[model samples]
Target: MLKNSLDCIEETGKGDISIWLTRGNEEDNFNYLNIMDTAKGIYPKQAEKIFESFYSDRKGGTGVGLAYCKMLMKTAGGDIYCKGKFNQFAHFILKFPKID
Candidate 1:
């Protein structure tokens, strides 16, 4: 997650990143760690495609980072996703089930 955030920071070089913990919807039954970058964001189309293997736009990028993250999150019974607008911000949310 930090790697992905740092990549966004370096890619845009415009604004800083913030990370915090938050609870999900009651029905959702999970907690979340949100990492948001104020730098320029990707298009919605690109965002949808980012988790696919070898789907990077960065030069020399292997495009394995996000794909791996998604896999790992699923393995742990959690999930990761992104939200943002082009040239505005990038928000990455990692969600985990609540433990009693």
Candidate 2:
């Protein structure tokens, strides 16, 4: 996903790019997540709506991936979140409580 986002950024030449990877918590054992891009302007707002079913800027997506991810995580006791700018970039966080 990081690679794809970077590729997308490079292709569009729209924003500054960077990636951060953090280890999962010992207590929750959440899946490790990678956050990429320097989301600044519209991306944050865009992200919120992106999770909605049947939503997509591109014609190809049924706009269900993120929404599905959210549902799957909830079923497993986790949550996903995103924040960023419209013109800048965005950050996404997926957290799962440490499972024993």
Candidate 3:
């Protein structure tokens, strides 16, 4: 999802794109999922709404993917969020608890 989202932004040439990826697990902490996106013309706020149902900054998607992801994560005791600066990079993070 993260890659696809980035691809959407990159293909449009709306930003300088780069990705710093990470994944790890701590003994009593959470599993990590991170995707950082450099989108020169994309604001994190705009990206934040990407998850809304039927809302796509661009075209050609039902716009329910991120919403569905949120639902599935909540069902599995996890969550998703984004952090980014306007005309800078956007970071999307999803974390899940380590199951015993």
Name the candidate that leads on lDDT: 1
Runs off by more than 4 Å, candidate 1: none
Candidate 3 vs. true structure, TM-score = 0.69
Q: After the best TM-score superposition of candidate 2, give how far the Cα of residue 5 lies from its true spot, in angstroms.
A: 1.8
Model 3, 10-62: lDDT tens digits are 77576544445344545536675776666544475686786777876655777
lDDT of 1 by residue, 1-100 (tens): 5666677778767777899999877788899999888777768788888899989887788889999999999998999998888888788889898887
Q: Which prediction has more favorable lDDT, 1 or 2?
A: 1
**If both were scored by TM-score, which would come out higher, candidate 1 or candidate 3?**
1
Candidates in order: C-alpha RMSD to true structure: 1.5, 3.5, 3.4
lDDT of each residue in 10-82, candidate 2, tens digit only: 6566656555556675554676464657523346558789678777775466777777878887897877877
How many clashes show up per model?
0, 17, 1
Model 2 C-alpha lDDT versus the unseen true structure: 0.66
lDDT for each of the candidates? 0.84, 0.66, 0.68
By summed lDDT, which 10 consecutive residues of candidate 1 come out lowest?
A: 1-10
